[model samples]
Target: MPELPEVETTRRGIAPHVDAARVTELIVREHRLRWPIPPELAEHVTDQPLLALERRAKYLLFRFPAGTLIVHLGMSGTLRALTEAFPPEKHDHVDIVFDNGRRLRFRDPRRFGAVLWQNGNPLTHPLLAALGPEPLSDDFSADHLAAQLARRQSAVKQVIMDNHIVVGVGNIYASESLFRARVDPRRAAASLSRIEIENLTKSVKETLADAIAQGGSTLRDFVDSDGREGYFLLQCYAYGREGEPCRVCGTTIQQIRQGQRATYFCPSCQH
Candidate 1:
């Protein structure tokens, strides 16, 4: 799944081509996605200009006067910007044609990505309404995390990964952030001290920002709009280096299952 950084990277990559560009047409070859692409999608935005491009959580927002087009690049989806009208591939499900002759192609082999419409404020839409503050926003502070963690007995990693607690800290990032904070992934959320919480908050921010700068980790199908693979995986310290030597310590990185997801850490470096 494309996490915050990967999603943000995609937003940045395609915004230049799509922003302020009038949509000539929106063609949905496959209506069944993470959610069915709105039937009236083309009716509303066919000739309207995209006013702005934004991201809330992992969803991309294409703002226009009529409404906002929200997109979620689920498990194995990519929205690529095309310089020319290239023929669609086997998995290419949606295409947004621009008046300028450029294109935005959405391809998802697993068919889990979404293209939905929301009137008024897209943030107020049900899918995004309950989402917590962005991990990079001022609303997400140590105090906020502490307040959320005060009563939770779940593992710290699991708690931070909760979308209601803080958005964007997915499984990969939770592991990286916990490793950077020097906290064990198995530590109870309530067991973290004030200092640990502060460090964890900072670590989360740093880890995410670094990943975004590196174009996000390409662990699976993630790629920028240009079809470029991310290089952050090479900089990973723990996420997928199980049984390998830890970067900070000589201890071998270990992996365990938490909530059915892999959690990697260095036993010696993290408590």
Candidate 2:
């Protein structure tokens, strides 16, 4: 699945072409996604100019006058901005044809993605209403993280991965952030000191910011709107380097299962 950075990268890639463009038509090749594509999606959005493009957590928001179009690139979904002449592929499930002869295409082979419509404030919609603060925003600082962690006895890794605590810190990021903070993933969330929280918060922000700058980490089936793969995976410190020497201490990186997800760290470095 595409994490925050990857999602943000897609938003940035397609925003220029789609923003302010008028939707000429809506094409739904398959409505049966994670949630069925709205049946009257075309009626509501057609001929309407897209006001803006924003990302909330993992969902993409296409803002218009009437409402917003919310998109989630589930496990293996990709959205591309293509010229009108671009041919649709096998899994291309939907298209928002623009009056400018450009189209935004959505493809999801596994069919777990979503294309939904909202007639009211999209931020108040159930899917997004309770989502925590964006990890890259000022709202997700050390103070916020500490307050949340203080109430949870779960493993620090699991706590950080919880969307309710801080949205978009996915499995890979959680491991990498903990490694950077030199905090063991298995430590209880409430056991972290103020200094540890500060370090972890800074690490999370830096890791995610760096990944976004590098265009996100592409493990598989993830690409920007331009069909380009991300290069951040090349700089990973511990996420997938199990049994490899740590970059900082030359300690062999270890891997463990936390909440059924693989976590990597340097036992000699992370306490």
Q: Write the per-residue lDDT of candidate 1 for residues 1-271, one digit (tens) a residue.
A: 8999999999999999877899999988999987888788899889999899999999999999999999999999999999987888889999999998889999999999899999899999998999999999999999999999997899999899989889999888999999999999999899999999999999999999999999998877789899999888898899999999999987999999999999999999899
Clashes of each: 0, 0
- Backbone collision tally, model 2: 0
Query: Which portions of model 1 show Cα errors greater than 4 Å?
Result: none
Candidate 2 lDDT tens digits, 1-271 = 8999999999999999977889999999899999898899989899999999999999999999999999999999999999765777899999999988889999999999999999889999999999999998999999899999996889999999989889999998888899899999999999999999999999999999999999998888899999999998899999899889999999999998988999999998999
lDDT of each: 0.93, 0.93
* Pairs of colliding residues, candidate 2: none
TM-score on alpha carbons, each prediction? 0.98, 0.98
lDDT of 2: 0.93
